[model samples]
Target chain A: MNSLMAIFRFELNRILTPGRVFWWVVVAAFPVVIMLLMMNYLQPPRGATQENINTFFTIALYFVAPTVSCMLGALLIAAPAVASELEQHSWTYLAVRPNGLFHLVLGKYLVAVVWAASATIVGVTVAVAVAGIEDPGDAQELNQDDTVVAATDDRAVRRGGRFPGETATDVVPGIVATGEVGRAMVGLAILSACSYSALYIMLGTLFHRRAMVLCVAYTAAVELFLGFFPAVINRLTIQYRLRTLLFDWTTQSDEFRNSGVLDFVSSDESAFMQVLWLVSWTAVFLAIALVSVHVREFTSASETDV
Target chain B: MTSEYLIELDHVTKLYGTVIGVNDFNAQLKPGAYGLLGPNGAGKSTLLNLLIGQLVPTRGTVRVLGQSPRNNSAFMKKIGFCPGFEGLYATTTGLDWVTLLLQLHGVRSRPARARAADCLALVGMSNDMNRPIATYSRGMRQRIKLAQSMAHEPTLLFLDEPFSGLDPVGRTEMTNVLNDWIGLGNSLIIASHVLHEIEALTDSFLLICGGRLLASGTASEVNELLFDSPSEIEVDCSEPYRLASVLMDRELAVSISVEQKSHGGDTVRLRTLRAGQLWSQLPDLITRNGFTVTRVRSADDSLQTLFNSLLKIHRGEI
Candidate 1:
């Protein structure tokens, strides 16, 4: 429809404004340094059979996706979500024309998704390609050896991923590639970015100016906190659900899957069941966001009252 | 082009729970110029919002261009409104703002751009087209607000205090633009407390008080109910001495006295519009052949009486 296209064009033009573009460039370009580092001289041990390149790419995204998506999508939607229009006194300018509550909510929601998706795609793709090109040594010890616990000193990079050791360095630590399963790892990084964007956009609508506080407290106390707990909270935290969707986990013995990580939740339930949980929670949050948009009065603070 | 009345409200009343916005209001409006004259906090803004279908009434129905205005696109297209406050996109350029408005009204491409330019020119702000509204002065902002309202050629205009915060020059320009807008058989409903400003724009008025319809008619009709109290009349007598002597003995007349002043020799001023009783007997004392006389005017035809009578009626002691 022309109206939908007009709304999309208007929203895209708004995001491409100078101030927003400058910030997007910064967020999109942060993982390029990691890519450059990996391309320098990190070849695998001579004569070591190289696994598929896709695993390394998934390993790369594990680092950049979490940081970039949180800052870009979670924090970015705060402005266009609800408060910016109030500051501009643009209600009459917007409401007079028939961009009713539904259109307004839909337009902003779509922009937030596209914005986060663009930033996340860059970080994920570059990290994936760069990780695939570079190689790490000691394949048997890293992938299969039993008593070889991950060393702490070189492991301080601590980027989360599909693997068990330093063989991967994108942003988050530990991307492991077993056998010939590479493409599934790439799919995992993308799923992480999308799920995170959806959750935060819903939060942005629910809490207008206080979005940062909610995200920080939720990320720290709930997500990181629950990830540490031995209980089944992985079904709720975004990080856990994202990790559950990425790696092809069979039993609970994989290094990244050991004990209190995402594996504990996966220890009992199948990967498909965990994905269902992620989707159900996403639906719940989206429903809350729609209600928030409908109830919150779109009054401008500067010149309008009551 | 719809030939029927653009807006019609029948006993529309709105209450914010206990506090009332507009109470028992009824109006039949055709396509012409109309002024909604009322003091501050007089519910002028409330009535305007109801007409636009932004707020629903508790009691009666309001029909704009024959359909209920609530989400009625066909009716909304014919009515353009500038609310009590300046609702502008502070970041948008003046030209782009109007163009967007016209485009939303289904004006496409180059013609929308051309019409936007013409609208800015009519509001006397073509030079400031590139500037963001955030940087504009109050008068310039008001002009842009008007340009957006009229850009789409709406048939019914609802302007709530459009002349507020305008300098004398800006006021004249805005009034002229609105007057010209209504010249093409279009209608305007404007609200203002400035009597002189309202007087210049339209003679018909709606006086609102305590969320009630206090008075509605031509300006003079409301004025007559407000100020004309004493039964006084001006007489052009043929014989000054004889005519002056005749009016001295009336009981209802307040000290029936005659004073001579300006204009050719002697003149008398009286304070009444009920001149029929005085003219019947005044010819008895004076002969027209002695001196041919000319003018007769009501001394109490002042706005002060209308204002006082309005206040009295508001207090419920009248």
Candidate 2:
């Protein structure tokens, strides 16, 4: 326990260098910067209703919350945690301590999760605040001829479309709350941040020199490609589970179905089960990372010459 | 493995793929101070790594403190290792590095900080302890490495090439500190290619070459291995001719060369197979000739000669 805490503190101090903090701040504000640009320059064609604003906010959350802020932030911080130590020839000194390798991995894992989650939260909060300022709730009704066109991924735009099934007198209105969406986005960001951090840390331990390369390949193969496929393999990815949970937790499902685009993927799983799947994946990958560090050889010669 | 020895390696071998790091090595080191003498690429670093449990032997067993060193926390707790490479967080200060290492050894934060300060001071690094390691010179970095190892005060310490980057004064200071540590009855195994530096630290040594142990004994005993080769001695005297005549007459000298000194004396270098015989007969030779012997120095009494002789002996050449 003492060794774990000491290594945890040490890893945190080592990572909180001045240059690293600057890059993190820049990454965290990227989502907010994009939102500001769209609000001022794009303007949604002038006759846009509150439903269009809600669609824009939902699309923004899909991109910035999970894809950009969470994934990129976790990759930048966690992918090099162990690889950097090996490259700098500092692994041997720490490896001699009792259970030092285990503590080192755990400590760095914690730092990456906390850092990435916080950055994503900051970015999401700013984007949601800007979304409200752009289209405050005065116009919640959609015109019959108004087409809700969104960013790339036709499925995502279909998911972000306005609902047509709700009457004006319905107690639960058709209008999406930006703050509510932000809360759900926050939960997704935290879960994805942890899951990505765990997976990348495992990759780092498995392929010390080529960790980043493997990470890129994994993202392209699993998260980006298989995650969107309407098959059983898609369920293996955290993206699939996160998307399922997002629809279940918020009013987005009712809005998306009424928008007239049907999803083949099953949304029958409870929010609790999807969250459990994500947590389980995190645990399994973290366990692999810990076990790899313990069993692998990280000599100075292996790191430098070979 | 026996409990009497702090470190035991029985026919241990470490192979890095087809390359041999340590070849059929065998040694049992008791609790004391000893130098690991070898040149570069002599497997000193590899052997030290094995001893510290960083690398496991391929074919044999290694035990420290009567237990296996591979992931043996109990054994590691009583041991400290300072590697040959510069293994430090470049952005951190010396104090921070040492304190973190101390805390990893299970010391609390407050005590680790105090112990780190004391160890840095012991290595003569108190003034610059707070500076980032990136700004430190090669010598200061070596000192900080040593400081981190010593901060925890282990029962046994393994230091590889500890005197590599030290200047003369710094070497002297480090030597004094190591001597004090030994004076306290803790064991130390210091590795260095330079024989004189090892000679300055400890009287006992282990001579290794090509991943094998060549010899192990006291300084005098190792030097005695060079007796088969002609020992070179330099003599400064007032009567060079007379001294040469006496040495030649007794047949005590195998070869001799004389150079006329500009300061009204002669300098003669003599090579004799039997230095002991010549030394026993030196007083009579000098007194009989009434020669004023200002200096008598042995040229073959160096580590390089001892190592050369040890290698030859290992090959059965002498």
Candidate 3:
């Protein structure tokens, strides 16, 4: 435990350099910049209801904050955890200590997750604040005749109890509740950080020589490419689990279902089940990373030639 | 009771694909200071890696402190290793880097900092400990590497090419630090291709070549081998023929030849089995004959030449 904390603290200190902090600022401000541009150039129509604007900003937040910001942040931090050590010829020093490899991997994973999560959560909150959430009573007054309200009411009646979206609005009776949207996006950001950091750490351990390239390839192929198809394989990805949780928490499932684009999500699974899957995948990736670091021979480049 | 031997390797062989790294090596080393002397590509680094648990043997076993080094954390805690390569972080200060490594050994932050400071100071790095390592010279980097390795005060320390980038004064400082370390009664195994560097630290040596152990002996034993081996000597002189004739008559030269130089005088080159005798008698012969000798140089006195002689002896060629 002491070794793990030592590694964690040391790595965190190393990550806070001027250059790295600049890049982190760029990551956190990305969604806010995009949201500002979208609100300026792509204003809602004159007759469009506040619900439509809320849904648009919510989806934008999901894609930019949890997906882009979190993925990029985690990738930059975690994908080079072992490769950096090896390139610098510093692995032998750390590998000789008791539980060194295990602590190193876990410690770097924690730092990556914290750094990525903070960036995404801050990005989501700033974007939400910039886009502006209307008062709940005013939004409800304007959304009284909207079809989304009717659909939400129908689903609530069918489910025989209040769903997450309805319960989220008990204090504010509107579709675009600031507290609910911010909470859900922040939760997904944390999940996205944990899951992606673990996956990238595993890649870093297994293919340390080409860790960053392999991680980028895996993210592009498996997470982005395969995540689009409405197949069983898509169900196996963290993207699918995170997206399902997003729709469930934000009450956006009915809208996607009506549009026939909900085929990729396992709607049959509850939000709890989706969280369980994400957590389980994180555990599996972390386990593989720890085991790989333990058993693999990570000699210096010169020694490898010998 | 503690184990009798600090390290034991039994028929250890490490193969990188088809190339042999350490070829069926065997050794049982007691706890003391020893040097691993070899030319480049002689598998000294490979053997060090094997003993430090960075590489596992393909055919045999390695035991350190009576325990297998492979994945043996308890054994790892008792050993420290400083690799031959430059492993310092460029952007980090020397103090921070060493302290962090100590922390990895389960030392608390406060004590780790204090110990790192002391070790750095011992290596003559106290004044520059707070500077970024990127600003350090090659010798300074080497000193910092040594500091981190010994900061934890392990029971055993393994150093590979510890004198690679040191200047004369830096080498003296490093030798002093290592001598002090040995004075503490801790075991040390240092690998280097330079003979004098190892000689400055320890008398015992394990000579390796072509991934095989050629011989193991003390400094005096190695000197005896040098004395017995046939050595070539060249004398630049005004009277090459006279010097060659005198050397032959004195029975110091097994073979002698005099060659005409392009400039002032001729040069006399001779092969002798008794170089010490030749050196001792040459001045008297020169004084008696009044020969104008300018320079006397030994042709084969390098470590590579020594290893070649040992290899020849190992093959029964001498």
Candidate 4:
């Protein structure tokens, strides 16, 4: 336990370097920057309904929060966990210790997950604040007939949940509700960060030179493509599980189901089961990383050859 | 009790694909200081890696501290290894790197910090420990590398080419630190190609060539292997013909030849099976004949001969 904590502190110090921190900051604020540009420059219709604004927030959470921000943050931090050490010729020093490799992998895994999660959460919070929910329409129109459906039938609502496009007074409360959903999305973002970071850490351990290439390929094929695949293999990915949990937890299954975006993501898995699967995936990847560190020979002479 | 040997290798051979890194090596090291002497590519690094448990042998066994080193954490805890390569965090301070290493060895916050400071001081880098390692000179980097390995105070130390790039002063400082470490009664096995550097550190030596152990004993044992054949000596003299005629009748001179020097002078070259005996005669011959000699060279006293003969023997050539 002491060794793990020491390695944790050591890895934290490594991650906090200026070069690494710069990338971390860039990834964390990316989602907010996009939202800011969209709001200020693109200028959504001045008369846009509160439902339209909520839809925008949901879209940002999907691409910006989890997909872009959390992913880049995790990839930059975790994908080089072992590879950087190998390049620097520092692995022999750490590996010679008792339980050194195990502690190092676990410590680095924790640092990557926590660092990426923090950045993603910070970005989500800032983006949420900057992109506050626009006021819903008149209170008397709470029972408005077709305008609510018409107002909420955009891409964002189609991808996520139905927006309550009622009274302008309901705007604040509805916006507050959306904020709650956004918070849930942030939680999912953290979960996905840990899962992805764990896998990348394993890749770093197994293939020092090709880890980043493997990571990019895996992200493209498995997470991006296979995630939208709607097959049993798709279920094996963290993206599928995270998306399933996202809709299930936020009570947006019906909304996205009524629309068509949830078709490929259709799964009846409970939130508990999805979380269990995601956590299990993290554990399995970490185990593989530990075994690789134990089995592989990282000679200090390798640095000279380079 | 565990095996008394600090390190034991039994018919160990390491092959990287078809290429052999170390071949048919065997040794049993006790608790003491020993020097690993070999030219480059003679398997010094490979043997060190095997002893530290960084690489498992392809054929045989390697045990350090009576335990197999491969993933043997308990055994590793008792050993400290400083590899021949520069493996440092360039952006971090030397103090930070050493402290982290100590902490990784299970030292707590304050104590690890203190030990790191002390080890750095011992390596003569206390003043510059706070500076980033990238800015450090080659000698400073070597000192810091040594400090990190010593910070944990392991029982057995394995250093590979630790003196590679140090200046004379820095080398002396490092050798002193290592001598002090030996004074503590802890064992150390240091690998280097420099004979005098190894002599400065330890009298015991292990000579390897072509990935095989050629000899292992005291300094004089290695010398005996070099002098096993008749040694050739060349004398550049003003009266080379007279010296040659005189040496021809001497029992110690197995063969004698007189020839003109390449530049312009005469030279008398002799091969003596008994160099020591001939050495006594040379002084008497020079003084009695009132000969003026420009240079006396021992041609066969080169390390190349020993290495060449060892490799040839390994190949059954001689």
Interface RMSD of each: 3.5, 2.6, 1.7, 2.5
lDDT of 3 by residue, A12-65 (tens): 999999988997998899988987777656645444445555676777778898
Give stretches of model 3 more than 4 Å off: A43-49, A135-175, A253-260, B222-253, B256-270, B273-305, B312-318
Ranking by lDDT: 3, 2, 4, 1
Q: Which scores higher on DockQ, 3 or 4?
A: 3
Backbone clashes in model 4, listed as residue pairs: A137-A167, A137-A168, A138-A167, A139-A167
Report lDDT per candidate: 0.61, 0.78, 0.83, 0.78
Which tens-of-lDDT digit does each residue in B1-318 have in candidate 4? 199998899999988777778889999988899988788888888888889888889999998888898998788778888878887988889998898888887888889999999999999998999999999998899998899888888999999889988999999989999998999999999988887788788888788876788888775666576554457888989988778778877676778888885789987888886666777678888999999998998865544455455556556764
Ranking by TM-score: 2, 4, 3, 1
Worst 10 residues of 1 chain A by lDDT: A153-162
Query: Which candidate tops DockQ?
Result: 3
Number of the top candidate by lDDT? 3
Estimate candidate 4's alpha-carbon lDDT, on a 0 to 1 scale.
Answer: 0.78
In the range A1-306, model 2's lDDT, one tens digit per residue, is 787788778887887888879867876888888776655555444454555456655756667776777888888878988998888878878887767777788888888888888988898887776654322222223435543332333332233322343322221111257667788888888898899999999998898889888898898898988888888898898888888777665554345557643254434688899889989999999999988876666674442121
Task: Please write out the lDDT profile of model 2 over residues B1-318, one tens digit for every residue.
Answer: 249997789999988888787889999888889899887877888888888887878889988878888777787788888887896888899998998888888889999999999999999999999999999999999899888777788888999888879899999999998889889989999888888888887888999988899888886886666655557889998888778888888899978899887877788899897777777788887887799999998877777778877777677776
How close to the true structure is residue B33 of candidate 2, measured as C-alpha lDDT?
A: 90
The per-prediction tally of clashing pairs is 15, 0, 0, 4
Model 1 chain B: weakest 10-residue lDDT segment is B248-257
